[model samples]
Target: MRQNPERRTALLDAAIEVLAREGSRGLTLRAVDAEAGVPTGTASNYFRNREQLLVQILHRTRERLVPDEATLTGPFDTAALLRDLVARMRRERSVHIAMLELRLEGTRRPELQAELAAFHGAELSENIRWHQDAGLPGDRHEIVLLYLAMLGLIVDDLTTPAVLEPYSVDGLIDAMVARLLPEQPVN
Candidate 1:
């Protein structure tokens, strides 16, 4: 019932670890509190129930997964930005793994579907902000497509290396970016 920012974050980290290690079925406030090494009631103090805890996981994943805006700026270097994105994904791999697990569980749960939708809406808002900041030409629909494509690529890059040479990370990113953005004249 009490709010402690640091403990709440610790609980979220523990939840991610539990989800990654044991899947959504392992995610309960008691489990999270135990994993966090906090008191038995700590996680429940922060999250009302399992759905609420899962929603927090989604929020934390969105917060941790999006490429930092400050890092994404300066030049329109799709390859470099994507490289950075991949690096972030690798560095926070557990969070992403948990997200993937949640995405699967969401298919069977309506509350989770709503929470996942909010996570995606937040992601799209960030994409739109990045596009506007970079002076990129894509509107929301195009951005949505681009985001989905890149998400697929990210999952593939993390799980399985490109089976085809043309689909290698660099080639894949270049192709995705080229398809999304309008052509520019040579300098």
Candidate 2:
């Protein structure tokens, strides 16, 4: 099969749209083809199977969630970063829903579980690198805790929308920053 990046991206976008609008249960090759304005055979030709298509969508989602290396810098403004993270999460609602579905699907599919784990591991690595660059003082255990806390925020925001009102991401970031970097009193 010819490698047409544009067509592939279009198909992936279509898949995400379908999943977002109709949920994972409604996702099908024909649906994606119609959404992408491509023929059903073309969609099938690109993704040999439904599983492969779903995996591709997940991969694309991972790419969006993980910040670029260039964006990871030292002494990051925690509040600003938190706001950006929140925005990114909100923008990727479809991906989040798809991830939840993927987790359930992983129960019977070991390969899916492995893929999810690998993606999570990569996310952790990126977080660790960002923390190191930010001059944060902590061992791997501490950094892991921070990362877990961030994940908790994401999950909470998604599952319980009410949490966002009382404790905004910016507020959480402020609290975390205070704990991570105590202020030095002026002389």
- Candidate number with greatest lDDT: 1
Instruction: Please provide, for model 1 over 76-132, each residue's C-alpha lDDT reduced to its tens digit, 9 standing for 90 to 100.
Output: 776567767877887998898898999999999988998788778876797788777
TM-score of each: 0.84, 0.81
Each model's lDDT comes to 0.80, 0.75
The most accurate candidate by TM-score is 1
Model 2: CA > 4 A from native? 66-75, 180-187
Over 63-123, each residue of candidate 2 has an lDDT whose tens digit, in order, gives: 6677656456645665566667777888887777667767766776798788878877887
List residue ranges in candidate 1 displaced over 4 A.
137-141, 161-167, 184-187
The deviation in Å at residue 13 for candidate 1 is 0.9
